[model samples]
Target: MLYDIDKERSALVFIEFQNEWLSDEGILQRRVIKDLDAFRDAVRTGARIIESARSNGWTVVHAGLDLRDDPDYLLFNGGRDVLGLRGAIPRAGTWRDKGVERPAPFAPLRGEFVVAGRSGASVLKNSTLDPFLRNRRIDTLFLMGFATHVCVESSLREAHDMGYNAYLVEDACAAFERAQHEHVRKHVVHHFGAETNGAELIARMEG
Candidate 1:
């Protein structure tokens, strides 16, 4: 079913899209740049979504990965590692630590919402995203960002559980692997919310 976005009750939560994942020299991109065309397309689509949402009066939120002060978040704390993220974790201020600090293909415009200074997979977990959403009375959420099967999926599930009607902008998000990307879009997205393309979302906003 195609859901119409009510501007007054809707919000667009862009997860990640930070320099560490999107930039050409970023760590994750360096590891997966060979297959990054899809991811890049997703980011571009996300940018369009933001533009449409902005003009349509839908709330915009930037859920960034700000791990600047807490470098040992994943290493030391086992309780918070619900995602079971293993291996070397990237710390902010490092050579590979690029987030909203530097310009990438997308950056938040002035006076827009930003939920920065976070280390958790879900923006709601480590940031004020939940409170902000609640404060704004935003019930419908349009989600987009990097690592579709990881952080994006994690947050999607959380949003669903939180009783928000969420939509995953599939073309506006990417996984590390193409298989992973397709897997989440095919199987997992429905479990949380409807999967939508940028064009459809933009059309809905424009309408």
Candidate 2:
């Protein structure tokens, strides 16, 4: 069933659309470049959805990854391997060899809020996002961004548990491998929230 999301009470969250993940020489390029065409298509879809969501008065939130502290858990633990096959999440700009310092196509614009402190996979943890949403009376969430099985999945799971009506914009997300992306969408994410696409979602927003 298609969830009837009220724009006044829903928020669209874009996770980790940073240079380290989506730029030309991004850290994941070595692993995901094989599906670069699919990834780029997803980005285009995401950008369109973002524009429509904003124009229609939906809350737009960019949940960015903050690796500024270079946390030890991400380095020594298995976080590095899971985040990037090359090992470890790169900080913005300093890792020039890894990628250029820039935001991806669907980057946040004026009046859109960029929620930071996402050292972990879930954007709500160690961050002000949850309260921010609650304060705005947002009861539903629409999600998309890099590595569908990682941050996107983690945040969606948390949002569902937090009692927010969560939906994953399937065509607006990307992963290192097509198989990984398909597996998570089929087996994992469906367990938490429903799957949606840009067109259907945009139609709902329009209606």
Best by TM-score: 1
Candidate 2 C-alpha error for residue 97, in Å? 10
- Candidate 1 wrong stretches, greater than 4 Å: 71-83, 90-97, 100-105
Record all residue pairs in model 2 with backbone atoms less than 3 Å apart, i.e. clashing: none
If scored against the real structure, what TM-score would every candidate get?
Answer: 0.85, 0.83
lDDT of 2 by residue, 1-207 (tens): 466667788888987667766777576655455678778888888888887887788888988765445534443353444545224543222233434233644567788878855546788877889888999999888889877888888888899888888888999988877887898888987789898899998888877
What C-alpha lDDT does candidate 1 achieve relative to the native structure? Answer: 0.74
In angstroms, how far off is 101's CA in candidate 1? Answer: 2.5
lDDT by residue (tens digit), candidate 1, 98-206? 4445353357777678885455577777578888888888898888987888888988998899898888888888888789989998889888888888888888888
Q: What's the C-alpha lDDT at position 153 in model 1?
A: 92
Residue 191 lDDT in candidate 1: 84
lDDT of 1 at 1: 44
How well does model 2 score by local distance difference test?
Answer: 0.75
